[model samples]
Target chain A: MPYTAEISRTNPGCFIFLVDQSASMSDPIGSGEMVQQRAQVVSDAINRLLTELSVKCAKEEGVRDYFHVAVIGYGHTQVGSAFTGGLAGRDLVPLSEIANNPARLESRTKKVPDGAGGLVETTVQFPVWMDPVTNGGTPMTRALGYADSLVARWVDEHPGGFPPIVLNLTDGESTDGDPTSAAIGLASHATADGAVLLFNLHVSGASGTPVTFPDGEGDLPDTYSRLLFHMSSVLPSHMRSYAASQGHRVSDATRGFVYNADITSIIEFLDIGTRATELR
Target chain B: MGAHSTHLDVQWFLVPKTGSSSEECEDAIDVLLSPETSSLFAAVSDGASESLLAGAWARQLVHGAVALMSAADEESVVGQDGLSRFVVEDLLARTVDQWDGYLAKYEAERIARGRPITWYEQPGLDKGAFATLMAVHMREAPADPENPKAVRRWIWRAFALGDSCLFHLRDGRLLTSFPITDGHGFGITPQLLGSRNRNASLIADRVSTATGELRTEDELLLATDALAAWLLSHPEVDSGGAGRQLGRLADLDQELFAEWVQNERDKSRMRNDDVALVRMRVKTEG
Candidate 1:
């Protein structure tokens, strides 16, 4: 019931994305045709997630501000808003503003089923809000702390609403220090609905079968993933149900953690909050 | 011998679900009165809120259903053994075909206007427009020459593909409720009619049908899921009290109905959703 709170424009939920922009993120992940810089992959995931959220809440009038969002980038001994263009340096912006003020829209070609067995290539408008940035060391602890402050304030302000969700996208390396305590502290903040949800997307170069929404850390490839898993909030029952519905092997104990795979699926785990009570 | 006949009193109301403005109401209802045949047809469709252009799809479906019923031949109208599987299936398949054409035109228009479909909208569109459909038809049986002064009887048939319900009341008591009977029956995933589903047999397999008799003063209520669910949840419905409440609304205008729905939603007695209802009463001449 915690995650079941109605998410309306009047009682919006919050999203805090912590993106690791450290130098090591510049390294290529996954060899061969799938190879891409860790930073690029994370940036694409963030952008796609934002687009998905915007589209989910979109109506004829435009996107509803059912959520407020923040994108924080940490690297080179600095942590700040990664939003570019018109929204540069802004934090916790309403979803309507985010939808209307995309840095730019890119026309991307996609192949879709043509209803006659084959695929048809078509152009689609894709909006971008942030670009890949790689700098110095991975100060992940500070990044979690930054999200912590935001979560603390958001819960205080929206005490009766669904708790904020913090998604940390990072490579396994942490140059600053272990982020366990910081992650725990970040997840400890609460609203009347529930405690903050700290989910992790480990964008690693290490090659292993990608594990997503695992209940235990036994299958994790490295200690870094295990640490992040330990710091993650268990998937609320509703999120677990959604993950199961999406064909992911989920259990009651499954945490909101995705390792070495596309984290775009995480967007589906968040309840759009408000039920369709009115249909206009 | 004096002639006896029955006429229909029809009224309909629609309100968008809570949290949505009135302009966003996606549920659609349509009634087709055929004075020449002394028959009345009504339909309601609830568009899946998750799908793109759902409101347009729902509106098209209900209109298509009514049109199909209006044009049915004698055999199709009476149906095979009281259930018109073929007619129902053909209606659904044709609606899907019509939706295909609509989607193409919609896409072309968007492209022509320099606002092509966004990546976000494409996936939902490909899944096709989703909606639940229910339709009812009522026709007066020919009067018997021997008993010309007897009360006229009307034959009524209902077809349902999802959670939408049709409730029949006689003498102010609940007579029958079709498709869904309890509030627990409503789920997040109701059976939906997909715009791209071309298999008539598949559509026919999911369709449910019921037939009954309506005499003078009998009332029939057709409702989309939200209002139907609320009606089913009340214990009074079994005792006919709920039917009386619905029958009383036959003369109320849309604004009053909207207020009643809002009040129910405020009390948390009904789920906030686009609410639709069509009330039909059988009238008799003394």
Candidate 2:
């Protein structure tokens, strides 16, 4: 019952995404058949997540403001808002604004099943809010600190609402310092519903089977992943249940950490928790 | 068909979800009165909240159900007990066809006004619209054709898909509850009628039907899932107290009903969702 608070326009939830834009992010990931830059993968993930959230909260009039979101990019010894276009320097913009003021819409071709035994090509409109930018070094600690301020303010304002969720996408190399304490400080913020959730997505150059929502860090590839795993918050019960339903092996101790794989599915987990149980 | 003196009192109320304006109510109700044929039709539909243009779809479905029930021939298969399934399924199929045309026109109008469908709306539109449906048809049996003054009885038939329910009460005691019998039976995913579904057999397999006789002073209640779930979950319902309470509620206006629903939600007794109810009373002499 802790995370069961009803999310409405009056008591909206919050999401703060921390993206790592260090020079190391330019390195290519994955093997021969499928190769992509870490920065590009992270940018694509963010755009897709935004699209999923918009679709989930869409109504006849437009998107509803059930959540406020902020995207922070860390690099070159500074951390600041990553949103471009009309929302360039803004933080914690309402979901409706985010849906309506995308930087631009790109037409992308996709292959979908045609209800027959074959597939057909179709064009889809993809909205972009941020572009890939790699700078000097990863100031992950500062990024977490920035999200800490947002989460703290959100909890103070909406004390009775579901706690804010902070997702950090990084390459596990913190140029400033170990971000453990910052991550802990960010996750410590709480509303009446529960403590803030801090999840981590580690985009590493090391090649290994992608591990997602692992219960323990013993199987992690290196010390960097283990450190980030320990910094990540345990998956809330509701999120764990959703992950289980999606065919992922989950347990009470499972932490929200994904390494070298698509993290866009996390958007679905977020929507499931904030879903309006009753039609309004 | 001959004109007959039969009286039926009907009332309906609806409330949107918490934090939503009344204009956003997704549940729809319709009452069809055919005085010449001595028949009365009522229907209620709850649109899927996750689907696009659900409220419009729900409105269309309820109106379509009543129109089909009213226009069917008395000697047709629709009038038979086991064969009504075909009629109801056909009605849904036709509604699906109409929905296709409606969607085309809606999209065209939006584009003509320079506000075409957004990227966020495209995925949901591909899935089409969805809703739950429940309908009732009541007709007065011909008074002894030879003795026009003889008292007449009414035969009522109901068809339901998903969680919407029909309740019958006699002498202020609950006599019957259709489709869903208990609160535990309700679930997040009820059988929904999709706008693209054209398989009549599939629809028929999911539809439930019930028939009964209505005498003077009998009361029938048709409610969407939220209120229906509350009625089944209330402790007093099994003892007939809930039926009496509902009968009293039938006389109140929409504003009062909305207040009552809000009070229930405040007390955490009812789930916060769109609620709708239609109450019908039988009168032998009026």
Candidate 3:
């Protein structure tokens, strides 16, 4: 019942995204035959997160401000707001504003099944809120601390609402120090509903296979992946139930951590209302 | 199957989620009285809040179900001996086509108002709307000749999908709970009817039907998911009666109903979702 707070305009939820902008992120990561820059992967995830949230609460008037969001990036010696365009320098912007003030909208192509044996190419308008930036050291400790500030203030403003969820997109490397304690500090912030939730998405360079929401770190292959996994919050009951129903083999110990896999699936963890069983 | 029967009292109560406005409420209900057939037909649908135009789809679904059932030349559209699977599936297949017409007009009106659809909303619209439906049809059974004075019965049939429930009550006790019997069954993303779905067999497999007999002393309650869950889990009902709260359900007007719903939500007795309730009691007086 802890995360079962009614998220609405009167009592909204909050999201704080922590992006690792270390120089190593510019390096390409190859999984099978496909290659993608870690920075580009994280950037795409953030933009999709915004889109998923906006579409969830959208109505006839427009996207409802059922949530407040803040994106913070850490690189070199700085940790600050990652928003671009009109929303630059701003922290904790409402969802409606985020929906209206994206940096730009880019047309992207994707392949879809055409009800035949083959796939067809289709174009979709993709909104961008941040560009890939690979600057200096991965100050992940500082990044967690930065999210702590936003989460602390948000819980103060909406004490009775659902707790803030901090999603950290990183390569599981820390330049400042081990980020375990800093992650704990960030998750300590609490509202009447529950404590802050810190979910980690590790974009590893060395990957045999992409792991999603693993309950244990046994198959993680490296220490950095294990460290980030240890710092993540367990999946809430509602999200866990959804995962189990989807045949994901989830349990009470399942954390909101994804290793090398697309973390955008976590956006579906949000409990807005009854959604379609299948997208089609 | 008909001997000029009618529902004596028909009342419906609705309230949006605690923080939402009236327009934001997505649950829909419609009751049609067909004098020609001496039948009472009703339908209630709970729209998935995450889908665009869900409320409109729910409205269209309920309205379509009742209209189609009543207009059918078949003696009984859906009953114990009725082909409920065919009737319900065909109704869904047709409603989706009607939704296309609704969308066309809606789009034109938006353009006329100087505001057009946005990119983000298009995915949800294209995916089509989804909602849970509970539809009922009732008629007086022609005086069971062998048991002529068998409490002057009425036969009712209901088609259901998702967590919405139809409760049959007599002597202030529940006799039946359809589709979902417990509170834990809610919030499970029950199989929803999509706006573009035309697969008859797919619809038939997901739909459920129940038939019951109503006496002069019997009453019925049709409720959407949230309220239905609360009723199933309510300790008051477990204490041997639904008398205090449910007995007076038909007596409540919109204002009183709203107050009761708000109180339940404040006490954390019910989930904070849009609620719709329809009450039907037999007319005892000749």
List of clashing residue pairs for candidate 2: none
lDDT string, candidate 2, B42-62, tens digits: 999999988888888889989
- Candidate 1 root-mean-square deviation in Å: 4.0
Best by TM-score: 2
lDDT of 1 at A61: 39
DockQ values, each candidate: 0.31, 0.56, 0.42
Model 3: per-residue Cα lDDT over B110-187, one tens digit each = 889988888777888889999999988877777778997565667788888788889888776777888787778875
- By DockQ, the better pick of 1 and 3 is 3
Residue A139 in model 2: lDDT:
89
| TM-scores of all candidate predictions against the true structure | 0.86, 0.91, 0.89
* Residue A251, candidate 2: C-alpha displacement in angstroms: 2.2
Q: After superposition, how far is residue A48 of candidate 2 from its true place, in Å?
A: 1.2
**Candidate 1 per-residue lDDT over residues A88-116, each given as its tens digit:** 99989998789788899989899999999
Off by over 4 Å in 2: A114-116, A221-223, A260-280, B1-6, B73-85, B142-152, B284-286
